[model samples]
Target: MFNGLSVTEHREGDDLLTAGLGLGGLQSMAPPAFADATAPTAPELRRRAIWSNWRGIADLSPGGGYGSVYGSVANVPGREFSALARLEGARYPHRVLVQVPDAFDHDRRCVVVAPASGSRGVHGAIAVAGAWGLPRGCAVAYTDKGAGTDYFDLDAGQGVSLDGRTAAATAAELAFAPDAPTGSAGVRGVAVKHAHSGDNPEADWGRHVRQAAQFALQALDEAVPQAAPFTFDNTRVIAVGISNGGGAVLRAAELEGDWLDAVVAGEPSIHAGATSLYDYATQAALLMPCALLDASLGPLPQPPHAAQSVPQWTARCASLAAAGLVEGADTATRAASALAQLRATGWTDAALRAGALSVGFDLWRAVSVTYASAYGRYGVGAHPCGFGFAALDPRMAPRAATPAERAAWWSDGSGIPPGAGVGIVDPLMAGPDAIPTDPTFPGLVCLRDLAKGNGGDALRVRAGIEELRAAPPREGLPVVVVHGRDDGLIPLALSSAPYVAMARQAGRDVRFWQVGPAQHFDAFLALPDYGARYVPLLPYVHAALDRVEAYLDGTGTLPANAVIEATPRANGQALEAANLALPR
Candidate 1:
């Protein structure tokens, strides 16, 4: 194996290599001088290419199917049953789980569910659809959002394949086959797979979701051929999503408002321009510097060298304070608090655990907390420096750039090195009087002007913010947005509140619900052993969904804008509405 060949290749009657040369003996034999040896084989490269393009993996288990849905076991009790539907389009082919009731009224509606972060592709949408859509005699389709597969695939056509498994049966086979009775209800829906999960430099989050929404519409159109018993009401199709998925749906509503009848965004992480700059900068200052420092200078303070390391971090804090990014008085205090926390718990273990949870934290709560705390400060105005600092800090110093070296790098006016990640500060710095000068912090102006010519970073950041901020809901299109008042991750004030205000200002038919004491994951908490500590907010979520469905069905009225104070039972089963207070 070390020689890149199996023992079988050299075995002669089990003797191995030349006669009587076993695996150990073969090590002593030198290769022929004339033999041509190369690196990776053609087959290996081909295998990698195939794996990279593959979107969904095949599941051959008795009940298993594409995108984590099991046809046999995933069926809801008596009311509804599920089957995997393959939707092939010109650009992409996706498999979604379609759940329909045993029987339904002639005017049944269709729902498209977008899965949340960390959800198991189509499997995650099952519970939400079962509780919300299936009971109403609605045909619900749950989208994977590419959670179980490679979400980064640019070419949507080359998705992973799930073939030849008993559980991998198509929708036509289970629901729309000619032999099946037309009287029995069949599902007409599609699950959309997200293009890219993360902040890919190539594409923004808003653009990716817009494309996914378009793909979903195409998928629904394709479902028409497979759905015989059920006539999919595309005119009344509603999109529902939670968390990151909720943000995607909101973007979809903005980009594809004409295609959607209504949108339900629950605890959405909406990006609202530069409003989050300060908070984002604070997090960068608090979390990033230490990690970068530790990476450069071995394990923070090494015994006798503790004093030497303290000054470097102090300088970073001082820089922020001088720039008026952080409160000058609190700089030392905050550093002390962080250092004390670090000292109480050693770096290695805590860092390892933190690193494990950091992905989820950064994606969900990091920026939220940053915004909350930045605005929470006594009297800090809009400071663009924070945004500048957050972008430049990571690349400001090399792993070997010590405290003294950084000081020189900043002082010499050499600017960021050629290969440093794009700097946004430079363009802002180039404009006369772009960055206000502070008498106390003499270095602020120099730091601001460091990236004078590099405008790419600034342009990207600005464009991203503008793209992410959803356009006001289209006229006559009803939008229902539910936000938890106590949501610490993506605060209601920063995300939904502003968006709601914008929508109302534009006279869009929109309803905003503020549920008190309900955290972001409260609905998921209601599930068995899901979130034991959080008070369940699923009942309120159901209430909001009920309103959305009613409005779509044209049978009921939506409540006026109001704040609902919800009280939860200890068992996470029930949520009581204590009071409904109208927004003043």
Candidate 2:
């Protein structure tokens, strides 16, 4: 339940949809700035936070059809309600925010409850739920689902207020307050809620999603007092989210309730009866670099600035070979062995091919290290792989964050570190500064062993994984799941496909839309070859949402279960509606 609530209404140039930044501002090269870098106001934090979220969550670049196509940032005047929802006796807080556009209809009330994708702040779904629902006068409900940019700075003894400005850790209702930083982590450090909360927060994502919807109804009762009493029975609630957010809605469906009328989940990272993120991410962190060396994959996206980047992934091939993981005397043979091993594990060629993009960014380790700690329920400074988070110095050594940098974390930090200037660190590294080497091979190997081991840490991790699996969603619930064939991060074969099959086999109504030439990340669609080779997945997500909305409204039926063969855009060509291949 909510501990407290704060409300603010937006009018004039400032509106709910874009956080006062219209399409132009959102499409700007940089995010909106804080007036005073060292001492930002709450409103400044909110606006810039929304701007940062828009870029991370949506593809706002020239080709992906944001403003000109499916989405719009047209000012929708509305009142904003923010609150923290927490289980009893917990320091970590999950945010529930409601945006009630002025156009909200009392006669036909609707709410789109979308949890934040990945580990983002409250506005993370503004690109999806906010864009789609606000214009139609439906309130948008967002929850971090127990993960967010509510960073706790151990060095400064500071956390963030609900509005995201820096505040003392001792302050009342700080978003997060981890156990006092201890155990000699070797550098001034920061803590993220998802990894350090010690609560195995993902285990409770379903509860948090339900709480967000509950809060949305309470907020609406106060926002439109004239309408008074708006309960789940009378008001329509459509739940939609992507990635982690998507998994949350699916979890919510498993609960026995009518609070959610329909669900549209895209690339959901749910651990059904198949491969969980931990099972694959650690494998990816260890073998992807070696696998990328296979020339047969052909022009796969390597890490940005590969020619200039350190860590020499070629060293990774050597490391894997030496560890007896892959059988090969040289890089080429080693790469083939790695690719063969991945295929034997049931990974599709498209998934491995698309995964090179994430491999380049080191996202596999980023996700693995974070999730490993979360699953093991490790507190701050106790990462099983010896990983820590901190702002980096010029030489890439961990350092205390500057006031301005600390002030911007709420808006700039990606919920996960290694973003917003704060990076993953190895406190156990012998040198004063950690140097990039062999792409952090030892750490990845350690994580992989934990996955296959049965130690205390492994037991904890597997136990948490068990908690994340979904039972069949309650009968009579309708669900539309959309996943891209090219999604390497959370591969379609490993996640959505099996879950949908099981739910339907249990006699639940679940629609599956597997889209080709589409990938997990719409934001990455702006990249050069990425834009040319892959279609954005969000448009299909929107199509699913539209169809479900019609079904709920009695205007139409749900789309059939089938693959949608979308077309890749030509090089230098603007994305067009014809490329979507959405079912008629």
Candidate 3:
């Protein structure tokens, strides 16, 4: 919510500001600017906490997870800045040395530092970067919890154990339970941990998940207290997160209530119960086994001569239905429709054998292995990216198949019909399956109980946001959400849809910014030295940060563009280039 700072207003022409690094400290450069006014050298820039080497950065969100290296920054005398990062932690990992103002703290009010989720033990470098840029004076503080050992899996086989969802890193296991500490003026921050693994049974996973959430909340309590010295009453805390860590912010508020004032979730994955969004018929007619070919086999395989000897795969739905695992008229019809579609779609023993054996005699065998391992019950049809129907059908060529093709593939009443719903599915599985539909796609809909479930905390976040808008201001909790238009992992539409609706419905003050051409990780991992032609990430960050400050001060308005542009740079000089637009 800090909106006081401006790149153009402060920096003179031709000066590069301190840009953050990307995954593994990958370096990129912003274009040379033509503006004016030099900041004073050694202009009494105040020093805050020190950030050392950030090891494997855990870039997590509700949708999925990735890792990165840390970027380092020292305060510059003037209001300009520079920094660098390594792409994938390669030896020389793109060291960035940039400059920014020492007074650049967001809102110049308070700085509350939060840790990346699931990064309790790992160094700061492993944590995902914050969604909004930090203002002068405000800096995130990091702690070292030793690694090489799985923190969440500590009591994996022993029994269900719980960690406090305390962001302050100072709550008692039971006391903090599941929320970020509340009532603070300084910047509010939290340390997040990944929720229970897939192996954890859905039945009794809440206790452990709550414990982890409790830890995150406790961190908030420890990091920024409400007392006089801490002055949490003065500054607003920005909730920055990715993957499961992002979910943690929502969970903490859900369980603890009124903890985190504002939040930004990346690749957010909210869970769905029992059924899926895609109907059984749709899966059969459109979701072919061949679709899994590339992700499983690296490339397509050929057919074998004695294909009958090769095994054929029926989706888990068919098997479950036959074995009485799935019952009821709706489910049975769905299953039967899918099976018939598979058979008619040429998912025969011969096709399987051929694709399996094209490479070698054991090619078919390899295919079967992939079927069970990769496309089995647990991991199938979850992400939109992996969803069989969403893939571009090469046969269709340049343009995707029209409604006619879909009609041909779709069976009347047998499959999903026209508007079957595939509820939300698993995080990694949702991308492949997420597709826009008239009445919305019928597929797996994942809905987690925020503080209790393994993931999908976004839905639970509604209550907290509502409560905040109704309540008086504890501090200026400015919230700015940035998402990539073409993020393959987690579509930007999903992230912004609920958020925008919520803001409008509640009439609350929040800002939403969408970056174009930028995919999931690409948007966050931009630097200033890659070159002029490359895209500039700082502008996006700056814009959002400025908005955050302004909103807190009640002086700024959200920008009106699908993708906000930064100062122009030549293609040759740009380090990373991508333009994203907002969804209609």
Most accurate candidate by lDDT: 2
Candidate 3 C-alpha lDDT tens digits along 1-584: 11111121123322112223332222222211212111111111101001111222221211111221112232123332111111221111111111223343434434322333322221222223322233344433212111101111111111101110111223212111112223233211111111111121111112222332223233333333442233334445444444333433333323333334455544332222111111211232132332322232233222222253222223433333443433334433544454354445334322322223222232121122112112122222222222221213233111222332222111111111111111111123324543322111222222212212334333322222222221111233345556545333333443444555554455545456655444433322322211221232233443454555565567865544355443323333322222312222
- Model 1 over residues 188-263: C-alpha lDDT tens digits? 1111122111221111323333333443344334444355333223434566666555665676667543566677
- Give the candidates in order of TM-score, highest first: 2, 1, 3
User: Model 2, 1-584: lDDT tens per residue?
Assistant: 79669999888988998878897898898878767899999889889988988888788888778887677788999899999998665557798999999999788899999999999988888888998899888999999888899887888888888878898876666888888553245534888889999888888888888889899999999998999788999899888999999899999988886777998999998988667889988888888888877888877753355574324667888888888999889889999999998887768888888887788787998898888888888887788778889988876687888898899988887788789878988653444332345647777777887788888888888888888888788788888999999888888888898898789788888999999977778888778788887888888888899899888889999999978898888888888888888887
Quote the positional error of residue 448 for candidate 3 in Å. Answer: 16
Q: Each prediction's TM-score against the native?
A: 0.48, 0.96, 0.38
**CA deviation > 4 Å runs, candidate 2:** 88-91, 181-188, 302-311, 428-439
Question: Between prediction 1 and prediction 3, which has the larger TM-score?
Answer: 1
Best-matching candidate per TM-score? 2
Per-residue lDDT value at 44 in model 3: 10
What TM-score, to 2 decimals, does candidate 3 have?
0.38
Error of 3 at 259 (Å): 6.5
